[model samples]
Target: MARSTAMKAAGLILALLIFTFFSLAASSSNNQIQILNAERRIDLSSHIVKVFLTLKVENVGTSPASEIFLAFPPSQADQLALVKAQAAIGKKKKKSYVHLDVNPTQLPDAPNGTKYFSISLLNPLSSGETATLEVLYILTHSLEPFPTEISQLESQLVYFRDSALILSPYHIKQQTTFIKTPSTKVESFTRVEPTKFAGRELKYGPYEDRPPYSFSPVIVHLENNSPFAVVEELLREVEISHWGNLQITEHYKLVHAGARHKGVFSRVDYQSRASVKGASSFKHLLASLPPRVHSVYYRDEIGNISSSHLRTDYRKSELEIEPRYPLFGGWKATFVIGYGLPLEDFLFESPDGKRYLNFSFGCPLAQTVVNKLTIKVVLPEGSKDPSAAVPYPVEQHLETKYSYLDVVGRTVLVLEKKNVVPEHITPFQVYYTFKPIFMLAEPLMLASVYFLFFMACVAYLQIDISIRK
Candidate 1:
């Protein structure tokens, strides 16, 4: 009897111990998973402004995971650049691991529980990991709209969602203003949802997750008649020469996103509609270029666009380009523009001893979808350790190249993002190390040729006249 009792007690103790151990393990596991807390701020005091975004991620898991990563929205990524970091998953330390990938064909999307960054834990995480990523960037406007439509002449309005507004560091009470089209009126705005700050966010509504192909319809009727312009794709290139010239080129496809006209355009009706300035479906497209950027030309796969008139003033340069045919609903227009600048206009030596190139240009899109955009910036010959970064939201390092007129064929930085609006055209900067020898080679070569020509001329003059003797 005593032996049996002792055996029963041992069995009960073993069961209790196993249950307790599992409960603790489960609790620990729950605690190890972490989420990212992000805070984004935009300061727009000057034409050039800085965007600072901070991300804090915590891990709550029992066993150590190999890695963790965070993903950013494709649109936001185009305008952001990773500047500094202090990241770690375990006792093992790492300098940086975050990367940006572009899906130009789709809007920015991320799965739940997916981290924007990844971390490798050292001592398999008994607890969780905590990390913070900070990004600093300069924002510039890229989108342009041609205010002509086919059917009804509508007043254009640029809509800035209250959600996209970021706080400024300089002011506590006053926030940065997102200026809308001058003629637009704030008809009726509402905040259906809560925001980080009260009275700031204009919410649309809440939605429940539905199956694929199921779309819940929510219509917002504001003064926003501005043709929903979107350049689904844009390719912008800024080539630098330590040797002394900056060449800028851009290729883009734009589509009309506003309400479409039903039937063929009638010129007589269009002429009469002109009296009522805001009723026609034709949009007058315009692009703003840098004041110093000249020799502006516009063309597409078909050929040169003759209807374009490029004008520059002391303050700014403008390109007024008209399509071969009036752009109706769902119409697409593609064109390329090229211009040049003295290298001295934007390149400067950084305090860190690296040469950096700074330039800004405009990219405009009508209200249509941009499928893909590839931007390639060519660096001059003899450039070493070339690296390029942009301040706009985008996917990065899509491809690298070594091409003509290049010592290293310049670093070709390509950015692809989708569903981009016109107002998002922001300036991007590229920084790299330059070789000084390249700066003088061309000038010296020219001087040597001139000197040799002069010497040869004098010798020929002295020897030729004696044929008579």
Candidate 2:
């Protein structure tokens, strides 16, 4: 009887709380921001969701709007980079780019434990004023591997879960989401009455505006036979020379990031399977570099690999190489590739008499994912006060590194970065003043040494006769 009474008391308290919530909600007068239109584009070709959100927002509140907020689930915040944002103007839709100040806040009682970024507007919008925002970001590891592991001959399947109904803190006028699959083989998807499904594309809703914080979940399954390749570490070294050229070398520790094989890899079985149904494993990699790349070489810790080919023309340049061993799921291999480009193509000079060297972090295959990157750029022996302007966040250090004929060690700028993806393959410029006199110092010193050696030979020959007498 006591246990029953306790349970009844708990129920009575829950009922009282619900009654209080309704009573307060009915009396509340909350301001609403109306979303006029929204469009989301998801690129399924990658292991990430490259999302582009275009929103038209109107402040239906009584006061001016100074900021806007975007919410994401707690699980998706860590690897996301807010790539770009632009404010759109009147009918012609001209855009004036403005910098966004990102302020992140986590609320304890938020539905789904949502974490929001409050983007502060440069200019406050008046009530009833309309503005459009275009935002871009990549959601990494957004696809989940289904059946986690696959047999050597079986195809890979992945899953993507999102919402059919758009969820927002404010009321939405109308919204549509378009999903593009990586491959043409979309096996199945959630069959909801409000969605239209076509061959590789899924479209959801032209539904009427829904109340605040409403959502409906949807899921998709697809077959992707593409190799999921990742580099555990990529060490890129750049040496700058004032004479003519810039030399770049990269060492890669590569791994297949797809489903693991259930058993030991059998080459014979793989060959047999390839003859029947084309090999699903990674066979080759194509790396892109700036045009006019020369003296290209490929090797590994053991020795040189002969299976690399370089193609260069007026239009584009590419280096295609194959690993020593065929890369299957859970297998690893390492290799080094080096090339040289004209220094003028990447270096710049400032009117204030400073020299800047700019180079890309991109490898031959810029699309390949990398977990960590260490970049070292060696400046001239006397170059001083090295600083960097990079496109992404990085940790930097200055080290004394020397090369051939270097007396005072060159200034080596070491930049460390993590979680690199293809989209981050942008260039960064390292600035330092290179004194022109330093260029001729090495040549002049060599000439002096040759003159001294000639004089010494003559003196030794002239003194030999007197010694013999």
Candidate 3:
């Protein structure tokens, strides 16, 4: 009994020592990095909030540092959709930016549950070395509609909340922030010292000697009438065939995520007073599709929608669709768009004799956000060991789908993602192994049915009718 008790005490002491060492190490690493200058640009010209940050960082630590951390408040972190970073190389005019890997990380001692995303440097920065970083991040659902509900004639006004100071884990020597609104009509803004407003731009700070985790809150109220289109759910189905064509169908639950519309909506007033009324509403949406797309169609539960147009060329295809009625705030529309492509364009066989279907992922609509995106790739029957290659992480699972002339059912690869933006529309591949003989299954089945019917008719004719005899 005494021996066991002693062992337990020793284990507790070791665990405490380990925790203390790591805590101190983290503190020391954060203290060794400092910002010489920082410039932040906020673009509020659209409902989506975009922030560009230019940082000049210097390593003051004795040891080499390989990573830099970006800080954001807990409230803003949930709204963040994208984070990207680049490092500037060379001097002045000759400088070029190289993409760097940035990923979210957790800190045990973070105050207020601050979120951190670490940028990995290409080369470690030795003591006294400096580097320049260019970062861009996007946030959705960050703008708050002031009135929440507005009349058709009233213009949209939103409130944007952010900090005038750069949020970082390292101390900053100086920082400045610039905000650009969509229109020159600014209702009000919180002013820090040295704040300036010129036209549609608001400038704040050039503050000096700020400590780590510093924040000075500011709010700006301005006019922005850009379409706030959000897809509540999107289901994309890509069906591949070994014959000659590949088909894609997308179902969407779309909504206008701007200020809610109140009072009775008058079609005549909305049409006649278009210039100054219903500024935040939208009627049309454009989708960018792959080149040489054919047989494109858009329809809803009411059948084919006529207010849409498709333009195609060798370079690209564009489809502009209009909802049955104009989409106002808090309004939703559901529809499906489908098209076909030549099989040669996407399906290819590798040297190892493995077949893969290369296709684009995410919502094809321009400048829209997808709350939940689900992609289903239906591989040809007799497929073995199907896999999906996506650039980012997605929830993946396999399902069986039965279609025409299918015996064992087709393999479907389902990929699910949330909080997707237009930038997520990149190429993904689905690979599987298939035998050529499987392509003949449908034709052979048809042939057998025809032959059996012919034999039955011939036998019936030869037998004749017993009553007539």
- TM-score per candidate, in order? 0.49, 0.82, 0.97
TM-score of 2: 0.82
Any runs in candidate 3 off by more than 4 Å, and if so which? 1-4, 464-469
TM-score (C-alpha, index-matched) for candidate 1: 0.49
Q: Which candidate has the top score in TM-score?
A: 3
Error of 2 at 252 (Å): 1.1
Tens-digit lDDT string for candidate 1 (145-222): 233234444443322222332311011111222222223243443332322222322332222221211222222223
Task: Please list all clashing residue pairs in model 2, or write none if there are none.
Answer: 287-364, 288-364
Write down the lDDT that model 1 would get. Answer: 0.50
Question: lDDT by residue for model 2 over 1-469, one digit each (tens)?
Answer: 9999999999999999987786554223124467888787777776656887888888787677777767676666666643556676545656456657666654333587776666677788677888888777677556777867877777778888877665566678788888888767787888656787677788887767877667777889987666677888999999998988999989999987776656566778767765323344686899987888888999998898999888899766888899987776678999999989999888999787889987876445745777788999988888987899997778999998877777787999999987777777778889998788898878987898899999999999887665555
The global C-alpha lDDT for each of the candidates, from Candidate 1 onward, is 0.50, 0.77, 0.92
Write the residue-wise lDDT of candidate 3 on 206-259 in tens digits: 999999999999999888789999999999999998888999999999999989
Ranking by lDDT: 3, 2, 1
Candidate 3, residue 467: lDDT = 79
The superposed Cα distance between candidate 1 and the true structure at residue 213, in angstroms, equals 24
